[model samples]
Target: MRIKDAGDMTSKAQETTAAVSRQRHRGQPYVGQPMERLEDAAILTGRGRYGDDLGVKPGTLHAAIVRSPHAHAELGRIDATAALDAPGVHAVLTGADLVAWSRPFVVAVKAPMEQWALAMDRVRYVGEPVAVVVAESRALAEDALDLVRVTYRVLPPVVSIESALDEDAAILHPGVGANVVSDRRFRYGEPEAAFAAAPHRVTLTAHYPRNTCTPIECGVVIAEFLPGDEGYDVTSNFMGPFSLHAVMAMALKVPANRLRHKAPRDSGGSFGVKQAVFPYAVLMCLASRKAGAPVKWVEDRLEHLSAATSATARLSTLEAAVNAEGRILALSYDQIEDCGGYLRAPEPATFYRMHGCLTGAYDIPNLLVRNRVVMTNKTPTGLVRGFGGPQVYFALERLVQRIATQLGLDPLDVYRRNFVAADAFPYRAAAGALLDSGNYQLALTRALEDGGYDELKRRRDAARAEGRLYGIGFAAIVEPSVSNMGYITTAMPAEARKKAGPKNGAIASATVSVDLLGGVVVTIASTPAGQGHMTVCAQVVADVLGVNPADVVVNVEFDTHKDAWSVAAGNYSSRFAGAVAGTVHLAALRVRDKLARIAASQFGCTPAEVEFADGRIARHGAPEFALPFARVASNAPHWSPQQLPAGEEPGLRETVFWSPPNLEAPDENDRINTSAAYGFAFDMCGVEIDRATGRVRIDRYVT
Candidate 1:
């Protein structure tokens, strides 16, 4: 909960390699400072341009996608003749049309139920888009959708995990022969011995249902194409290159490069469902191209729930192997990943990503993750707040408590015993993910101490004596990020996936420029759906440059053509606070070097001799012999060698693209990224369950 003097590296070397730090006071004005958002002025003054805010309006028409009500079905004739002739209705198209134009492109993806931009022959999931209708107005688009009717030979939808694998079950796809849509099995360590030899082993099965992102703005995209030199320029809130791009490009039948996805300065929020909106933009752009007008489709509440992706509904079984000392030994798991219908998004990436981090922060030495990405009649499951971390964490963390109870050890003791030692650098998860960095046991100890675990348990036991039912739950999770990946809805062959790319994810680009007036502006590629990238990015610059936070400006909008950015992998995983800060900081350092060079030329001193503080540059001592940063900028430009020092460039600024290395091979035994930074938090959740009715209520929760 707090960090203090993380290993005590003094002023001579301020970087502390402390395993766990509570130095809230020390890492300030940068990492732990209480700073306001840089975009606050514009956002508060109603100048922030969200998805629907930035656009060109010129008889912009609306479009609606007609979806199949059945989970699996044989398609018949799609009668859009009436809808096409209806007043204000422009056109209607289907999966066949998309396929005919070579519009639907399914990249090398999870095989079983390969994705389709539009349902081609059979519908695999509920709300699978089968056709589209474009109309003159938003109201007209809704009314016109009812006119396009497609009859179906509906089969009973595959609904449950137990029923999905039966040989006699209705085949969702005759070509695939099964509801399974994953790649292959990936195994690492030995599991049978741990399963049989452990002093205590227990397996628990639990079902976690689908949960959607609660983004304030539902998915909306308005697209237009340019036929001349500029190409297709789509301006909307659709961002990221997930399976949606492959699906929409195929559905729209356009080159990926031709479809330029321009997200607004602000997206409402991104829990990951927004990735699906990109393909929709491509489809809308194709429709706009066909109709010779801008096509806009603003998803209403029902459409969002019925159409967009949600976190996968899963039926998971967790097994725990505990030693005599409460240390975890070996574990086995069988999870039914309900990856919905398609394999576009982070289908394989999600499962594989977590498959490696599934064991949380514990030191479990052996694990087997058996996954079956099943097809269900629901919206496709995509990334939520913690991605796949929460489900497995809830299942395993809860089971650890019960395992502790069965073994007659403190639940927290079991947790502490199983944690990777503070010195266990580059630890590995049994499944296959590689952990980069962490001081696990230290973080665990700090959390237990900070939460006052002993004191709280004493109070809880006394409360029980008073006939009050109170129990505390502790959940520990390690989430993987900066991964170059796609969704592994289930375990699959590494070679089959096309998107779980960059073996070690990437960085963002930022541009810092000093105006003639001396004020600073930094343009970053990371757009905030609300994780506060802009505010924090500027802090990295201000801290590095020794300037007031106000004097430093951070912008989220940057030209992909001019600005150096590598199509930043989405802003989920709470990655901004750590990764983004470091990225923009590197950019600031580049600019700082330039500023130092300019100062050295002007003040008859080397860059190292000139230390900038409080936005002013002075040659070490002689504080009075200084110049405001603005004055240096005001005098730099135009033919003026006589007015300035000889042999100096024009401006005092710079920009650079940042990319961090990702070379740690994960321990496939416990799903740990033996390489990334790790921190700890204390969690307490109180649940009141009715003995007679089984009604559950979370009385209180804090993390």
Candidate 2:
């Protein structure tokens, strides 16, 4: 489980590749080099600090939220008098109290539903928090919650996307008129003509089920209101898009400066699950303010499972317009995603994330996609790993297989015909994502060869001859990264987007500072969910600065107060490799440039003529003409200011931000890159379904 070096993993992968007759040559070290992770030992040895491990002040009260048992209900009355009299119970808070103390949570998407930390007026989901109990201990808080009775007039629930979309369905949010929250269509190229002129047309439909990552540690929050500064100091186990500072501040009716969020040094895991923890953060802050003391709440398994956000479930229909030879000319998609009870901040993000990859690995020149968001009586859905890609590819790839079946063509052959040419990149997808680089055909061919595709087919035919059932399925997907922050604004109308002003790009920030002793420290905005972020940071910085990976330190904890962050910051959206790594490299390069200049002065050479290698600066191709990197780094912080390079800053420090090139604002067409780089995964899964026991055994998966 401990990743020693970048090569450590490469060696194992090479062994596997060699077993499959795919051995390749090794390359340079550092960024692509192997190195052991520094964070693993502390984590594996039980020294990590997770959410529940942190506690508030001595007299801090504990809280337990009372959630709605009914999916749809009208609020009648809440009786908390008995709970206030319970043992050790300090106070019981209801929607009425929150109404006086706070505003509804902010919704980033242009949906009509108004959401609050605690449900008020009516409950739309089964686990909506209706009230809260605060006490000296968690046990007392639980007891107090039971004593506080809430009366509800239960109403019919809109439980499914189909039911919610019914013409006669009850509107989940009263003013929205229908369960539909947002609906729009986007088209690229001549889709109508392409479908009309095509000799072949294929369609596929499927429902991607809703799921959530059950992180080992559930949501926990501790908030202390500093009345002296009129600000709040909150510590929680949450991977934040520090931009939430403004969102939570707005909900609390305080200025953004009054709120600060910090994460523990270690988190169990968040593959997008922690995105939903913000609402609870504001709730705990309210509890603290109401009780006039710090407050803490640790969610139990039941609460976590029933209330936490999930990956949005989607129902999709995909169509392809193809030539007589099976080359796709156009693609179309009509999809309805269940947003659950509320369109929380960034709810509709799942729908638009794959806008650029709608055509998948194809070079379809014409495309159209119609997306609709629906609200149902379930937990709200937000970000998850592979958030939108899985659902989109499920439908798109299934269509690819169906096309092959109908046309009597090999699936791989059909895919090969449609793939974007290797040299065609940076090719623009029909939608608008300017794909940076890829060799789709090369990748697919290698995968087929390595997975023994031909051999598998032979085995399948032999099995069928013996009256055994076997099948293999193929799916091609484009995984997008470096989430464009401006893409979310597409949910708003053109006028609204314009009123919002010039759009910001998808950006990530990193700070690199060199110590007088020549050590490097990198602080990034991203928090790790055991993803070896520290290891990657070390590798990238060490490679850029000409130092050992072990010598470069990475600050893994994401504290909004300490990190150089942006609105696009967070661990979601598959952004690290494209955005974070690039930012870290840029920052490190700045530091390295300064070091080179200082070393050049000492070595009596021009900066451009000097090279940094083995932690020393020397004339290019001359190892003897060198200055130790440490001696040069010391000049910035320890040397007399007069001796510093002219026009150079005083410290060997740099902070840089990165945004993808060729990024454009969403036009009236609602088209955008959505992500900077597109990483493709071609998967072939072999499985056996045992009809007797109805069990599925996955025999092999090649990606």
Best by TM-score: 2
The residue-by-residue lDDT of candidate 1 on 1-703, one tens digit each, is 7633423323212222111122223224554566555554456555667866766687878888898888788888899888888889987767665554444445335354545556777787778878878888878877888888898988787777667788887766566778776534445566677878888887788888778776788887877767664446666565453324445545555565665655567777767777667657666766776677778888777878787887777788988777788777887778877776665555644555566666777777777777777766667766666667666776877778878888898777877777767677576656544555677666666766765667767766876887766677877777665543322323434332224432334555567777766778887665568766766776677677766665666777533344545644346555565566677787778767766766777777888887766666677876765887666545563234255456666665567665545423332222334223444454666565565677877755656
Off by over 4 Å in 2: 1-28, 609-611, 615-628
Candidate 2 global TM-score? 0.92
What would the per-residue lDDT of candidate 2 be over residues 115-215, giving only the tens digit for each residue? 88898889989899998899999999998888888999988999888999899998888888889888887778899999999899998888999998898
Clashing pairs in 2: 4-35, 4-36, 5-34, 5-35, 5-36, 6-34, 6-35, 7-34
lDDT of each: 0.65, 0.81
All candidates: TM-score? 0.86, 0.92
Candidate with best lDDT: 2
